[model samples]
Target chain A: DAGVTQSPTHLIKTRGQHVTLRCSPISGHKSVSWYQQVLGQGPQFIFQYYEKEERGRGNFPDRFSARQFPNYSSELNVNALLLGDSALYLCASSSATKLFFGSGTQLSVL
Target chain B: QKEVEQDPGPLSVPEGAIVSLNCTYSNSAFQYFMWYRQYSRKGPELLMYTYSSGNKEDGRFTAQVDKSSKYISLFIRDSQPSDSATYLCAMMSAGGTSYGKLTFGQGTILTVHP
Candidate 1:
């Protein structure tokens, strides 16, 4: 079976641009969470969504938002991206048990 | 200080050597602890997990938590080149502000030479 999958494995954008990263959870998983991992740092929580609704969010700026679809897929959107936004965007699937993660979407803001 | 603290070691060791990684936390509320391994250009993958205190072992990996001291550790035996990666410690609490929310430590980079 397929594990968590994320789209646009790599993307490059200019500062002030917007970016949307997609994630398809493991076939039957219901919850999806997002994390940002900058170079030389651990992954930081961004948002968590379940049943198409946001269950929790991290301390990220309002510019970072996310939504889960009825099909259990999810998307992370970042508006007015800054150079600091350069990081790996990870998507993890959960179900109150443990989390299984995707390979991650590497985003680079110039 | 950050809720969780870890040594970002570019720790290098020969194959078959033992490896030890650790992290300490400031949030006493954190009860569930975990270790994740991340390879280059990939998401972090769960390596081991523990609750509150004590130890848990799986094959070549061992996870230990000391809630009383707010400290945790992960150990690997017979390490190989494939073991090279970044190790991250994460934790969450059962209630309060950190409930169901994990705070992470700066990851440690490990290299197991073949």
Candidate 2:
């Protein structure tokens, strides 16, 4: 089966702009999570949704938000973007314990 | 301090050499430890996982977790050039809202030269 898939493999935005990234979880998966990875660093957790409910949130600012749909797809939206926001946004799907990740969307803020 | 600390080693070693990677965590509640391999421009892929405190081996990779010390390790034996990539250590609590939330460490970059 296909693995977790993310849309808009890459994006370029300006400061104060807003951007939305999408993710489609694997079939039969009900959990989706978002993470941000800066250059030369490991990924930082942003938000996690299970069964279409917000299960957990990380130490991100209010500018970052996410939601999961009934079909288990998820969208991560960032408002008033800053140059610091340029990074790879990754989406992962989980069944119970293990998580499978997507290629991620690379966002560049100019 | 970060919840998890790992040596971000741009380690270079010859193929067939043994490789050792480690991470130290501050959260005592973390019960599950995992190691992931990520190539450039790609998301991390789970490599090894261990529960509580013990050692688990799969193929040439072995993972160890020590709850008392809040330390974990991943060892690669007879390493090949294909093993070159960034290695990340992740931890998770047993249940509750933290069940699926993973805390990751700074990735260690490995280069196995042939």
| Best-fitting candidate, scored by lDDT | 2
Off by over 4 Å in 2: none
Please give, for residues B1-114, the per-residue lDDT of candidate 1 as tens digits: 788999998899999999999998998777789999989888889899787799999999999998888889999999989999999998877743233356789999999988
Clashing pairs in 1: none
Report the TM-score for the A-chain of model 2: 0.99
Docking quality (DockQ) for each candidate: 0.59, 0.81
True interface contacts retained by model 2: 0.69
**Model 1 spans > 4 angstroms off:** B95-100
Instruction: Find the candidate with the highest TM-score and give its number.
Output: 2
**Interface RMSD score of each model:** 2.2, 0.8
